[model samples]
Target: MSRSTPRPEPFVSATSAAALNDLRTRLRATRWPDSPADAGWSLGVDVGYLHELVDYWADEFDWAAQESALSRHPRFRVEIGDLNIHFVHARAVSPVGPALPLVLSHGWPDSFWRYSKVVSLLTDPGAHGADPADAFDVIVPDMPGYGYSDRPTGPPLNSIDVAGLWAELMRILGYSRYGAAGGDIGSAVSRYLALDNPESVVAVHRMDAGLPVFTGDRADLSPQEQEFLDSSAAWGSTEGAYAAMHRTKPQTAAVGLTDSPAGLAAWIVEKLRGWTDCDGVIERSFSKDEILTNITLYWLTGTIGSSMRMYNANGSIPSEQHARRVEVPSGFSFFSGDLFARPPRAWLDRVANVVRIKELPRGGHFAPFVEPELYAQELRDFFRPYRKALG
Candidate 1:
């Protein structure tokens, strides 16, 4: 913990054999529901679909594959402010030049696994086309109370607090100057990183620049923005039930997620089903093992409770921070497939430098895993100019 800026420790623990056992038992005891005969995903997380998923998770799922992959990265923890962060510091493939340090953060329901594809691609961009000088020493941290950082303490942590932790983590990793990128909740935290440590964050990138952090009222909205705003409002009302629960009664719902493996699958599978490029069952997009492994991390680490703390924290965007213009150099990837892909140029312009924007023919919110090649290329291309600037 930084003596100057000590917060409280959130994620800390020795992984228990008992926790893993409890998860398996929960999976074994899952009481399944029956599906409507003609029903499709319209009902969300189809019942029959879930049964097939649960069986595979119970029998064939390889949790070790993901666990070992994550373990090989020299995982370590640091007491920063109040959070004990779990992170992987993978060195860049630049034998000659400055290894551009980069912290790739993930959003809700996604562990560091979301950025797994981009890590090697960014750190070894010479293989992809960009110069080695542009390569970044990637530090992908499981945000406090999220993945492995489960044992949170104190009131609740907010985006700015997370941003501060990122700053401290970057410094702890000896990254005085580094680039940052994220999507979903990751995007919000990255924005705060830029906002909090404008001097330290050399460049900031986000998948959802259209969330309109500080943009003003409806009077400030144009006709086009007005329509998008209306659609956003509708989506907020209908699709944001998950956010509502997290914001208000996270502890209440953490009960089921912390208990049942199948229950956690139902929660996360809904996102993979609802948010990914796949139109039908999750298998169409992700293997049952992949889906199960991600959820299992939450179960094994008991992160469900701490991760939900994000909801209770950070009430609404701060008045000054909201609609507040970001001065740092910024870039945006218009992964229009994601939940927050707002395309209005004005909406995006408010918070980003936006040197490059691409409209992918395919992909969705989980673009890193959903469309690795395209997403990797987007990262390489957007940071190309900065690579040149660096040299």
Candidate 2:
């Protein structure tokens, strides 16, 4: 470890009994909202489902079990710059040779929890019926304001700033070169990692190219590119109010979310249902426990405000940053139900040194969590050739 970077101490996820009691108290006392007849998710989070979910959350959901499950992975907290970052650092087991170091960045409505299932599969591939040579030393960090990590006091760190922090974190851990992968804000962070620290980041992978932004002439774009841009705008108008709140008035929205567990659950669960490949049945994609565990983390941390503020910061990123083309080798996996999964190859080529692109038949925006085995296989396949080059 470098002398300049402080050593990381082992961390365990433990919530006090008092906090648990408070959560149940709030869940029990939730003032119910009324929805029109047969209003099943037509308006924000279906009230009927929210009631059932909240009932389970109050009486049935097990935080201790979830916390224990989270702690089973080797977790740590280290100070990088002014913030103390919480990350899961699971090293490869029984590698055939040198294992490639890989950092996995997570996006909003979730944290390190997003990559929890894939960690062991990635770290110990042979045990999971994969080649030992495909093992990776995995690092999953809670982007500064999420989960157990410390929230930034000043302006929320944008994707570019988070990318720099990730690079320094890898440096502190003694990884001279590593690969980066992420989705949502994580996608943007990984993109910046490849763009700004190409030498250190050997290659990069992203779930989506993010909402399209072009500063160049409209005539320069292909018809497909133009249509993709138009469709993205439509998505924003219909399904992006939550994002609009995050970017424009986070504190105003966060007040209710941070105070009420039901509000928090409604906010996060709506996305989980809308974004995952559950076909309108959230339980098909995530159990009540899985859903509540993620929501409870937000309630306990009280950092929902800070996490949303990241959008406001990112909204201010310069136009040139959005236009910059990445030279680093890049791969993408566009899952069937994700937001704009099949991004035009032309648009991808314009921004990245497109090496590979795969469109899986299933899964959604939260692919790693929704389909861990498939997601793990995608990483192994995409980075296998790059691993040979590293040697």
Give the top-scoring candidate (lDDT). Answer: 2
lDDT of each: 0.73, 0.92
Give one digit per residue, the lDDT tens place, for model 1 in 1-391: 3456443233323555676566667678898877788786676667777878888777777676667665655466667765567777778776346666778878888778787666777777788776666677778898888777646678778888888888988877666777888888888888889878887887888777644433467787677777777777788787788878888889888998887777887888888777776755567767777777778888777788778778778665567775666677788776645776465877667555556666776678888877777777776666655543344
* lDDT tens digits, residue span 1-391, model 2: 5466699999987799999999999999999887899999998899999999999988988899998998888999999888999999999999988899999999998999999889999999999999999999999999989999999998889999999999988988988889999999999999999999988888899999999989889799999999888899899999999999999999999889888989998999999999988889999999899898888888888889989999999999999999999999999999988866356999999999999999898889999999999999999998888786567
Candidate 2 at residue 352, lDDT? 97
Q: How far is candidate 1 from the true structure (C-alpha RMSD, Å)?
A: 3.2
The segments of candidate 2 whose C-alpha lies over 4 angstroms from its true place after superposition are: none
Q: For candidate 2, give the lDDT of residue 78.
A: 94
